[model samples]
Each structure stands twice: as structure tokens, then as C-alpha cells.
Target chain A: MTGAAARTRALALALAVLTLLPFASHSQFFVNLAMLTAISAALGQAWNIAGGFGGLTSFGHAAFFGLGAYADAILQTRYGLNPWLGLPAAAAFGGGAGWLIGTATFRAGLRGSYFALVTLAFAQAFGVLANSLDITGGGSGILVALHPGAGRFQFTDRRAGYALAVALLALATLAAWRLSVGRFGAHLLAVRENEDAARALGVPAVRVKSAALALSGALTALGGVLYVQSYLYIDPGIAFSAERSVEMLLVAMIGGAGTVLGPLLGALVVHAIADTTRSLITTPGVAPMLYGVVLLLIIGLLPGGVVRIAAVRGDG
Target chain B: MAEAAPLLEVRGLARRFGGLRAVRGLDLDVQAGTIVALIGPNGAGKTTSFAMIAGFVRPDAGSVRFAGRDITGWVPERIAHAGIVRTFQITQPFAGLSVAENIRIGAFLRTRAPAAAMEQARALGSELGLAALLDRPAAALTVAGRKRLELARALAAGPRLLLLDEVMAGLTPTEVNDTVALVRGVRDRGVTILLTEHVMQAVMALADRIHVLAEGALIATGPPRQIAADPRVVEAYLGAGAAARLADG
Candidate 1:
């Protein structure tokens, strides 16, 4: 077997082992942590599509995530719709929001820091709107009643939720892999590297970027749907928080932004640190402070992220 | 007398930046299956004219017709899809990708399958004498290597009309000879080429027709021998007492 194939096999084995881990552990806290890690990994992967590959670093992914969470929460609470149906609806909402953002910004030729700031403003606006709206249960947030059935998108045991989260992560990772190996991914990377050159070579720069943003938004919305289903409650603060946006970008960057498994590895390290700090400290900001220090060290020492370090060691 | 319609036609193409007119009412034509050279001194708007023809720059007036269809003001990708592709004056390969991958992105314009694109990239690499460097990152290439990669990438797009901007600006004498042959080979393959060049030897050796631009407008257009003897061309580009120097060089 070639080195890449062997590496892929090893990764598959590791993921398989992780998916079966909840069965061996009786601790609900461990399962919950594992689920959170998987969800964050998926979210990071979604962001990587546009931010890493297409070179559109968005600081407002929370808009899509919040839209997804609200789509599910509102439909479930008011319309009594199944969460399975809500998934596609949430994805559509996210994609539509992405279309709007991409069209408005790209048409106006807003790029780089301007594009990032505009996206941030959009997320902030969505948060404020969600907070003021009565349909979103005002600032206090909306609660998802515990139906406790697979049909209701709720599981009686933590194992099912863990399984679902792992599955979603697997799906997201597969999608990222497919994109990285295909024509669309090449176009996106070309646009990222040099938009004018790409367009001169017949790759439609605006269309490629807009498509990437739409796909990313839809996938991120799926992550949001998973989050609300697992937690059974969500407020505008939790759903559309700037911290959530930062966390997603940080996880992807820490892992290696454009790589297939970078986000997953990043999520493991980040969530593990958060879980360990929570267990050891009563302080409110200690975990985030540590995260900042680690990020600084990573950026200073290994700008390519932890994946590059692993690749170098593997070569040795 | 009415002549055959040129593959690319530009008329009254103008552009301005504030008070400075970059390219003013430039009219140029390139017939099918020929290597045409656009020659000028520095700041003669050769690059700007190339950009306008390739749809990179919007013209203030006039139209560009490709295969007799108006393509003025079209987006670069749309114009490229209509079979007009361009290379940058400064090479712009995707530095992070391998040389083969950089070419493969261009090949993707013709094929959707990754395998097919890779095959096309390899063929182009071999054709351009860059097969050995295919797996190396583009950033690792020399200046001449980057220039070759740019040409290879443009070729990989399967262009009917190629607008080359300063492709042979920096190269050794031997490399220039090799590029002269390569340009001939490309023209032999039925791809019409419109190139801006400063290398007199390559232009004299390769160009079937030469067009001279002076101050954003065409000053002379003819066969190489006529262009070389044209006093107007000499005064505009070759300078005083430099015509014999150009001939000697």
C-alpha cells in the first residue's frame, strides 16, 4: 500500500474506534464531550470549504448556524414538524442566506478585510433580530421539548446521540475529501490563489466563490441542527455568538485549514482542553485564556497548523 | 477590397486612468492561424490592449469581436470560454500547488474528470520541457520556468486565440530560441497567437506580421522586413541612430 492509502486506512481505523467509544464508557459526561467534539469538527469542516479553500475568511458563520438552529426550533415548537424534515429546510435557509451574502459582497467587489467585516456585521444583525423577535421566544431563547424518541429526532440514550454526531462528522469529512479531489475544488483553490488568473483561464471566479459559500453554509446549518437536537435548547446568544464563529475558525486552523482531517484533530485538542479545564477550575475565563495561549504558540511555532508537524514527523 | 474577417478584431478601444489615457482608440486585428507580435517600448499600452482584448479591462469605447461576435465588456471567464485566453505579464501560477496541478487547473476547462485533467497536464508539461518539474511546487521554479508554466497553462486551456503578455521578457538566448520554436509549434497547431514582446530576435524570427504601438495607438503594421525598415517605427521605438543598432543586434 502507498503511504497516502496507509494513512487513510489508519485514519479510518481511528474514527471507527472513536465511534464505538461511547458503548465502552458508562459516563454520560464523556459521551457528551465526545458529541460536542464531533459537532465542532463538522462545523470546522464546513467553514473550511469557503474560508480555507476559496480564501473567503468569514467571521459570521454564526448567521448560518443560528438560522439552522432557529429553523428547527421554531418548526418543532410551533408547527409540530418532524426534525428530519426540518434538516433540509434549515439547509435551504442557510444556503439562501449564503447566496445573499455572496451575491451582495462579490457583486460590490468587497474582498479581504472588508468582506470579513461585512459578514461579521451580518451575524451581529441576525443575532439582534433573533433576540428581538417574539417567534424566537425573545432573548430568553426557545426550548425543544424532550420527546425522547428517534422519530422525534431525540434519543433516549446518549449512545444514539453520539452515534449520530459521529456519523455527521464522517459525512462532512467525506464531502470535504470529495471536494478536495475534484474539479470544483480545483476551481475554488484557483480562485483562492489568484482570482484574475483563474478567470482568465475560464474558471468563473464569482460563481465558484458563491457556490463554495452556499455549500459551506448548508453544511454548517446541518451542524447547527445537530447542536440544537443534542442540547434541546438554544438562544440567540448561544446560536449566533461571535465566540462560536471564532471557535469554528480556530478549530479548522489548528488542525490545518485546507486538509481533510485537520478540523477533526483540531476539535479533539480544543474540546479536550476545554473539558479538562472545566473539570479542574471554577474560573469563568480560564479555558478561553488557555485556548488563546495555545493558539498563539501554534501560530508562532507552526503556522501551518498541527497537521504539518505530524506530516513532518511521519516523513521522518 | 473586403478581406476575410480576422479571428480577433478591436476597434477604437480606449481606456483612461484620471488624466492619463492608457490605451486610446487602439485598432488591431489578428487573422486566424498566425503568430502576430505587438511590439512597443515601455508604457506604450501593449499590456493594456492585451487586457482589453482578453476582457480583463473594460474599454471606455469601441468593441472587441471574437470570431465576428461582439465580446466587448464581457467578463474574463466568459471571454475565455468563447476561446480567448490570456497570460499575465507577471506569471501568476498557484504557488502552493505543484506545477502539474497548476496546469491541471487550466486543463479542467476542457475536462471535468480529474484523471483526464491530470493526463492533459502531463502532456502539456512534457510538451513545454517541464515534465521533470511537474511534481515540484510552482514556487520552487525559476523565472524562466514560471514563464514556461504560464504558456503551458494557457495552452492547456485549449485556446483558439491566446493573448500573451510579455512571455519572453526574461530568458537566456538559448531559452528564447527554444520559445521561438515553441510559439511556432503552437501556431502550427492552429492556435492563433497575439503576443507582446520586446525581444527583437524572437520577434524577427517568429512573427509573421508585426504591429507597432506608439503612445497607445498603432504606428506601423506590416511584414517583419517592412516594419524593420519603417522610419516611423524607428522614430517611435528604435530611437535616433538606433535603427542600424537594431539591425546589427
Candidate 2:
């Protein structure tokens, strides 16, 4: 294998081995934290597919997250449907929303900051709709009853949830890695660099961007479903908040935007900082304040992300 | 000479940007396996005409046909897939990607497999004297290198009709000579070329037929020697000193 490929495999194997720690730990608190980290990494990876690789920087991915959470939570609470069936339903809903949003905005030739604002607008609109909708439980949100079984997609133990989160992260990383090395990935980057040039070379730019958005939306929705299941509840404020969208972008950017494993690394570092600051500061927003500083520092010092530094060093 | 049907046909291709008529009533044809030159003064609508033909610019009124098929108003990607590809006047390599990767993007137009694309990129790099620099990032290349990389990328798409816009614009004389030979070599390999050039020497050396445009209108079309002797062509380029300049030459 090539050196870079070998290094990637080794790193993946090491991370897989580390996922076993939550299972071995007796403390549920630590296991839960680990699960949260894994979920964040998965979400960040989803954002990376669209924002990083496809070069469509969205500032409103919470729309998909909220949609997935609401789709699953509402179905289980209102109609008494199985969570298993709701998962696919939520994914489809998210993908459909992605297709709709992508097609409309891209077809209209909205790019750069305009595209970002449109996405943000969509998320805010969805959040407002969720707040007033009766079926969604309105501003109070929906609560899913505990089925407490593997068949019901609910786990009795935190370790099992951690395992599922880790599995999701692994699958997301694998997908990103496969895409990074393939023709589709090349097309995505080409379109990102110069859309007109890529089009001249026979890449269907709009179609590629739409596909990326759909895949990213579905994966992010899956993360939302996991989040809802873990918490047993979801509100529009929690699921569709602008802060949630920024958090995903921060995680991806902090680790490495376009690299496959950057999101995981970013999630780990961001969570660690948040955890460390929470212990020292009692202020409600102290952790996020510190995160902003760290993001600024990272952008100023290592704009390519921490992963690129390692790549450069490895190459040297 | 008996002639096969033209590989590309443009009829009444025109475009206007607000009050500026960039191109008006431009008609062009490219015969199979021939190198056609579109020459004009700056702002004579040469680039706009090329853009309209390549499907990048939406012509205000025009029809573009390729290989006997009507392809007017098609998108750039669809036009490329129909065997036409174009390079920009300013080289636009993916700055973050390695040279091989930049070319590989074009190679992917013909192949679905990444390995095959990479192989094609490598082969094209070697053919274009860029084999040693394939691993280098495109951002680091010199202007001449970027221009060659741009050509290599367009060639990687396996185009039957290649539209080159100012491919020799900023090159030194030696580089222009080399590029002139390279462009002729491309035409010799069965690809029809439509090019716009400012270099009269290169145009004379390479073009099978020349078309002159002034103020977005075609003024003359003929063999290089015939064009050099034509009064309208000379007057269009040299203003009123055509006969004197012709005598001086």
C-alpha cells in the first residue's frame, strides 16, 4: 500500500480499538460523554461532505438535523410507529429536503454568502414552523417513550448507545475516505475549485452538488435520530438551533475540512476543551466563549486544519 | 478540394451584455481534422464568441451545431460530453490539487474508475512535458507551465473538437514556437481545433484557414497568404495604411 493509505488504515484501526473503552468503563457518565463525542464527529463528517469537499458552505444544516429528530420523535410519539421504520423515513425526509433546497438554490445560481444565507433562512423557517406545529408538540417539543429493547432501537445501557455512536462515526469516516479517493471526489473538488472549468471538462456541477447535499443531509439526520433516542426528547430549540449548525462546522474546520478523519479529531478536541472549561468556569456560556477563541487561533495558525500539518510533516 | 461536412457550425451567434454588444451575427465553421483560427483585435468579441460556442455564454441569438446535431443552448458539461471541450484564456488549474490530480479530473470525463483516470493523467502529463511536475501542486507552476497544464487537462478529456482561447497569449517567442508546434501536433492526431490567437506568426504557421473579425462581425475568411494580401483584412488591422504596410512587408 502507499504510505498515506497505510497510515490511514493504521489510524482507523487505532480509533476502532479506542471505541472499546466505553464498554469497559464502569462509569455511565464517561460512557455518555464518549457517545456524545462520537455523535458530534458523525455530524461533523456529514457537514464535511457538503461544506468541505463539495465547497458548499452551509450555515443551516440544523434543518436536516431537526427534520430527522422531529420525524422520528413525532412518529414514535404520535402514531406509535416503530423507531426502526422511522429511521428510514427520517432519512428519506431529510434527503428530500436536501434535494429541494439544493435544486432551488443552485438552479437560481445562488453562491458564496448568498447560498449560506439561504440555508440559514431555511433552518430558521423550519425552526419557526416546528415551534408552532401541533403535531410536533409545538414549542414544548415531542417526547419519545422508552421501548427499552434492541428491536425497538433503544438501549438499556449507555455502553450500547456508545457502541452505536461509534459505529456511525466509523461508517461516516469510511464513506468520506472512499469518496476522497474516488472519481466523484475528484469531480467534487474540481467543481469546488472552478465550477466553469469543471463543467467544461464534462462534470455536471449542479447534479454533483445536489448529490453531495442529499448524502450529507441524510447522514446528519441519522445523527439526529441517535441524539433523539439517547435523550428521549427533542425540541426545535435544541435540534434546529443555529448554534448546532455552527458547532458542526467548527468541529470539521478545527480538525480539517476536507480530510476524512479531521472531523473526528476536531470533535475530540472541541469536546475536551468544553469539558475542561466547564469544570473551571461556572458561567453558562464560558465553554462556547473559549471555543470561539480556539477556533480563531486555529484559523490564524493552521487554516488547513490540524490534519494538514500532520500530512505535511509526514510528507517531509 | 473536396470537403467533408464541417465538424462544428455556428450560425448567427450573438451576445450582448447590457448596452455592450459583445458578439453580433458571428458565424463560424470548423472542418474535420483542420485547425481554424479566429483572429481579431482586442474587444472584437473573439472570446465572447468562443464562450457562446462552447456553451459558457448564453448567446442572445445564435445556433451551434456539432457533428450534424443541433446543440444550441446546451449546458457546458453536456456540450463537453458531446465531444467539445475548451480551455480558458487565463489558466485555471485547481490550485490545491497536484498537477496529476488536476488532469485526472478531466480524464474522469471518459472513465469512471479512478485508477484509469490516474493512468490517463500520467500518460497525458508525459506527452505534454509535465511528467516530472505531475506531483507538484498547480499553484506553484509558472505562467507557461500553467498554460501547458491547461492544455493537458483539455486534452485529457479526449475531445474531438478542442476550442483553445489565447493558448499562446503570454508565452515567450521560444515558448510560442513550441506551443505552435504542439497545437499542430494535436490537430495531426485527428482532433479539430478552433483557436483565437494574437500571435500572427503562430497563426500563419498553424492555421489551415483564418477568419478575421472586427467589432463582432466577420470581415474576411481565406488562406493565410490570401488573407495577408486581402485589402479588407489589411485595412481592418492596419486602418488606412494597408497598401503601404503591405509594400513595406
Candidate 3:
């Protein structure tokens, strides 16, 4: 108990300090960079819940992400609601969408690549809808007014936006941590390992998987809300980009899926590589190509992701 | 004398897979706290019957009644929730997780706390002679160890009715003997067990009653001694007088 308490306290302290570090960086460039990394970490951790732990490989997480961004944007710009309200709205809508997708696919017994394709289709379909919807401002997109108030969830200090991002990542990290040590997590991992075996032992496989997706979707949606609040503008292409979906999975996979700190570590490395490549190469295609090459090397060399490296080091 | 109703009762349970009549018109009953077995040659529909009872396979015809309530075609998890737990013929352990974690998931059925589940899992592991392997990965275990782990995992669920599929399918005679005693111990703990096995020695030693099947239907049902002597059974499964040979062995 004492060890557990100490570890938890240390973790909380670490997260708290991380949220405050952006303030110390006077350079706007560094602050924005930190914000992006934190955003990626949160999104990655969100995907990890379902993808890593539950063995639910979703290829279209952009669906929930875009839905959340659009939910906030529309609610704030069109419905004339407080941006803070968008936080809960995003979670609700994201969770609901996640539940819907999980129920539909799992009930139909879709798994592996089929489930992945279905989620991808959902995101692609949502992109089409967002592009054409009247309330979404269609292809033109919507802009959130620059309201600098805590109630509006946008702080006048640019670093405060970074703080919000850090806080979101912390919440996601905390959720993953909770799952690793909890009963629900045990059932989930059992289902992932062997669904029929788990069912024989009385695990409600479908329910557990569905609930995990909902939780993951809710958190992922919250990440979308953070993005909109930080930038104050969103269009269909930016909100529903397939590349963003790839980034979320890459962060978790490269950092080590099913691990608590995988996404955080993945976010750091992924963004560092992105930033370095963008600065070093002006050719747009070259930057993406370089990113792909580096990722391929990491994945090929460390198949279990960077977190497994920590495991090896700890044991050896 | 009016006998109490059976803990489990199957009436005319049937299923057909495409061109094959896998199970047809099968009936079964087991009283509380008894060690019964469903025995037959391969494709005798013993496994299929067990699957229907445990809710893994839906029956094409007839009903499954437990404690006087109909539970036909319920999902496997829901049937397990009703105190009926089944273990696979092919051992299924979460390979990456530790032996304790494998049992802990079963314990999770009754408790929501990890500490409690882990504690119970450890206790069950030790009871099943797996204390030393608690922290080891499940995939590291031998066939005998996996069989024990399967039992420990099911026992952790505190099941009233345990359906074991070929639990002793592949094991040394010594290991089979150990499992026979282990199963008898489980029955003494107030669990009703229904097993499907080709292990005749185990069947003779453990089963209070035995049901014999052939070609998707029951051809004989009696006590272990009588089952060994049934002419229909001997013709269908056992040789002309294997009972005397079995008794000698």
C-alpha cells in the first residue's frame, strides 16, 4: 500500500510539473511544440484503450476525433454555447459514437481487418457529411471567436492552452493506468487473449469491449475539443484527416501499445521527428517520406515499441 | 419416494451441422454434488452436448433446464453467470499473462476488486498444486500444468455446475490419477461435474453415473458398473467383455 501510494503521488507530481513546464518556455515556438506533443500523447493514449488493451484495431479514429472537433465548433459558433460545454458534449458524442460502432461491429461478429475497415469507412463517411452539412459551414468550415476567458476555456496566456492539453493527456494517462490495475482491465485482457475462453469463465466479452471503445472514443473526442479550443478554427479536411488517424495509432504502437506511458513517449518521439523533418526539409513530400522511413525503421527494429525497451532494460 | 429434481436437465436436445446430424434427441440429468460423465467414441456428440449445455452452441431442437428453469440458447457468458462454467477441450489460457492473472479473471466474476481477485486466485492456484507457477507466464506451463490451471480458473468462479471437456485428454497415467482425485475433491466441495472423456480408467473411477452416446444419441445410461456391462454399450463402444479386463487392469 505504501509503495502504491508513493508511486501514485510521484506520478501526479510528474504530471503537474509537466503541465506547468510550458509556462517556463518563453519561446512561442517551443510552447506550441510542447502543445502538439501533448495533443498527440492524449490521442494516442485514447486509441490505446481499445486498440492495445481490448484488441479492437480501429482504423478510423478520425471519426470520433472529427466529430468532437465539429461538435465543439458547431456548438460554440452556431448554437452560441459556452466552449466549456463543448468538453462534456464532445465526450458524450464521442462515447455514443464509439458505443454505436462497437455494438454494430461486435454484434455482427466483425473482428480484425473487417472491424478496422468498418471504422475507417465511418470516418470517411463522416468526412463526407461534414463537408456537405449546412450547420458545419460545409466545405468553407467554421471559425470560433477568440474569447479569452476561463469560462470559454481559452486562457489569454498562450501557455495556458498548452496546460489544457497537458491536463487532457494526464486524464487519458490516468485512465489507462487505472485500467491496467483494475478488474475491468483483467476481463478486457482475457477477452482479447481468447474470447471463447473468457466467455466460458463468464466474462461478458461484447459488453467489456464496447465499454472500452466508448471510453476510448470519449477521451479521443476530448482531444478533438482541445484542438479546436487551442486553434479556434476547424475545417472538414483538418478535422477529419486520415493522416491524423494514422498519427494516433503510430504514437501508441511506436511507444508500445497496452502500456501506460507508451503514448507519452511516443508523442515525444513522433513530434520530435515531425518537427525536425519539417525544419530540415522544405520539400513537402520529402518531410512525409522521411517521417515514414524513420517510423518504418523504429517499427522494424523495435517491434514491441519503445516501451518494451524499458522493460528489457529494467529486467536485464 | 419422491426424488428432488435434477440440478441440470436436458430434454430432446438436438443439432445438425449441414449434412451431419451432430447431435440428435439427446437427454441428460445430473443431481447436485455428483460426478457424472458423458462418454462415447469420437463423434459421439459428447462435446457437442456439453457445448449446448454451456451455451456455446445453440441447440436446433429441445431444451436445457437448470434448477427447474429453462436456459435454452442463452449465450455462454450468461449461462456461466447462472453458475454453469465450462472449460475447453483444448486448453485456453491467456498466454502472455501470468498463471495467477489467468485465474484472477475467473475470480473477477464474483468480485470487482483486483486485490481480492488476486488473493482468491492465489488460493485456488495452491489448492490445484500450481502455487510455484503463480507468477510464471501461462504459455510456459506444461500440458498437465495447463490442465490444472484450467480447473483452478474454473473453480475460482465458484461454479455450481462444472462442465469439463476432455480435461484428461492428454496426460500421463499418474497425472490422470491426480486429476481423478482432483475432480472427486471438486465434487465433494458441492460442485456438480459433467465430463466428456475417452479415459476409461478415469471414467470408471470417478463417475457415480455414466451416460453413453453413439451416432449423436444416447444408447445407454446407468451406474459405472452397469454401464460397463450394458450389451448395447459394449457393442457400440467397449469390446465384448472389457469390463472383466478393465477390472483386472
TM-score of each: 0.95, 0.97, 0.94
Tens digits of per-residue lDDT, candidate 1, A40-73, equal: 9889989988888888899999999999999989
Candidate that scores best on TM-score? 2
Please list the C-alpha lDDT of all candidates, in the order they appear.
0.88, 0.89, 0.90
Candidate 2 accuracy as TM-score:
0.97
| Candidate rank order under DockQ | 2, 3, 1
For all predictions, the C-alpha RMSD in Å is: 2.4, 1.7, 3.0
Steric clash pairs (candidate 1): none
Which residue pairs show collisions in model 3?
none
**How well does candidate 2 score on lDDT at residue B44?**
89
Supply the global lDDT for candidate 1.
Answer: 0.88
> Candidate 1 lDDT, tens digit per residue, B118-235?
9999999988999999988899999999999999999999999988888888899999988889989999999999999999999999888999998888889999999988988897
RMSD of 1: 2.4
Per-residue lDDT value at B213 in model 1 = 91
